[model samples]
Structures are given as C-alpha cells and as structure tokens.
Target: MTKLGLEAKDLEPTRTIFHSIVSGFSCSPIGRIRLDLFGDSSHFRREPIWFEVVDLSSAYHALLDRPALAKFMAVPHYAYLKIKLPGPKGLITVTDDYRKSIESARDGAKLAESLVVAEERRQLDRIVALAQEASTAPIPAEDPADKTSFKPSKETKKVKLNPEDPSCSKYVVMGSRLDNK
Candidate 1:
C-alpha cells in the first residue's frame, strides 16, 4: 500500500477472516483490496486480495494463498520452486530467487531465537522477583522453652573389661530390664 501511495482507509471494509498453519488462530483482515498483479508483461491478473495488518516485523511483504492462486489460475511446482500461469503469449513461469529464499529463512530463524530469548528473560525476571520477596520476609523466632537436654531412660551397671585398667570400664543395661529373645 505504501509503495502504491495508498493508505489503509483506501481499502474496502471487509469482515473476512484469514488463518495460516504457522499461526493457529484466525486473523480478521484489515480490509480487502483489488489490485492488478502481473507475472510478466503478457500475463496480468486483477484480483481481490485480503490483507491482515500487523505490527510484527517480517521478511516478506505479503503471502499469497490458494484464493490468489485460483484467481490467476496458477499452478505451483514445489520441487522447481516456480509457479506457472496461463498468459496471452504463452505460459508465464515465476521462479523464486535462491538468495532471497535463504535470506528469508535466516530472518525467520533470528525471529524465533529472539522470541525464545525474550521468554527466558521473562522467566528469569519472575524467579528474581520471588527471591527478592522471600529475602524481604521476616524470619520466625525460636522458642527457648522448647529446648531440652538429652538423658538416658534406663539404669545401667559399670563393669571393668580389664581388671588391670580401671579406665577400660563399660556400662551395661540392667538384666531385669532386658527382653529375652
């Protein structure tokens, strides 16, 4: 539209919705426009094309769908990366440039990488926020009354293993308290 010196207001209002496999949800078109598309000097088509205006950055200006292809009666050869359409002189063939296709693929990869980085950054921010909240919270105080010292519940007798050494004495539980196996 900018290349043609036309604005969005110039397009006829439409309620038509468009969807793509890349984007799962349906998009409402900004408007509909009838433009003359030329494959070559001999082959030209005037067709109504729907446009969905978005603020996202993209490598391609517009994506032609089945409706546009049907309007021009074009047959696309995926293996050859070319489209063949009927013309007054002969069959008009439109081929994609290899360099442009490579550049577009590179741009698409960069876009996907940037989106992943942005999501990771958001998750990091959330984790940082949670850490900050936890740090600012008050720590609970310990109760002094709950503290206790360890004590033995059973009575024991001291017996010297070596009679020559009094320091080698070992403590044994009372025989009456012991359970018989």
Candidate 2:
C-alpha cells in the first residue's frame, strides 16, 4: 500500500519484552508485517528454545518422531522467519517453518558423526592388522656364549668342603652352592 513505511521491533522470549511490543502492535490496526530474524549461538544458549537433554540411543523412536529430541542437533546459530502480515481487510495463511532449523542441525551433526566414526574404524582396523602381524612373526633369537673351545684356567682351585668347619661354609665354587663332605 504505497510503502506504509517499515516497523521494526526486537522481541525477547519473556513476557515483559513480548508485552511491550505485542501490546502496541495489537492496539494499532494490523498492516503488512516484515520480520528479519537472526540469532547467534549465544542466543540459543540463553533462550530456552532448544529441547532438554535426551538419550540418543534408546530414544531412537522418539528421535525419529521428534527432531527436537535428537541430541546431535546443532545449536541454533541463526534464523530468518519473515512473515508478510495481511492488513485488517486482507487474509493470509500461516504455517510453521521453525522446524527447519532443528532438522538442518540434526542432519549436519549426523553427517559429521558418521565421518568421524568412519575414520576411527579405519584406524582401528590398521592397528588390529599390525598387532596380528606382530603376533605371527618369529622373533630373532639372541646369540649364546661360545663354550665349545673354552677351557678352565689352572689357577682355579677345587677344595673339598668340611662340614665341621664354619669357614668352609662361606666359600662358593663355580657359582654353585658348596656341599659339605
């Protein structure tokens, strides 16, 4: 209607903020409405828009039925839900498009998780194969000392041990325990 001029407002989730804007809007005759919406990660964290914690594994049926129940859904980063409201005389039909944010978040998270799992599985398989190869391979044996050509020195003495003598008990021969005769 020849540019009725644009009206802008910032609405918060709380009643105080909503009431300030809504009250003013409701009183005036409704005209064409154009909404420009955007939000950061902090907005989602601050607002209670996202669903509460849910068990992703056991909640399979629930997750399939409700997108908000999916744990992998990304936090809302930004959104735009522009609506062209009808004047007092005009009529317009409105349907929900907010679910798109949650669906996109869930799909993105699922794709990222799948990629990570695939990489982890590939690394695990490589480690398992290496372990198997190590188990089957024979280890090289250490070389034994050569004693075929070795001879005992003449200086080495062998003495018979007397059980009655305490001094003889202290002596050990050839790295073996002495037996008292």
Tell me the deviation in Å of residue 68 in model 2: 32
TM-score of 2: 0.28
Q: What lDDT is obtained when candidate 2 is compared to the true structure? A: 0.38
Off by over 4 Å in 1: 1-34, 53-61, 138-181
- The candidate scoring highest on lDDT is 1
Report residue 124 deviation for candidate 2 (angstroms): 0.4
**Each model's backbone clash number:** 0, 0
Q: lDDT tens digits, residues 1-181, model 1?
A: 6876778887787777665423333456667666676465456554555555543344455566898888878897766768888766677887877677778778777766766687689999999999999999998775555345444555655445566876775654444455545
- Give me the displacement of residue 112 in model 1, in angstroms: 2.0
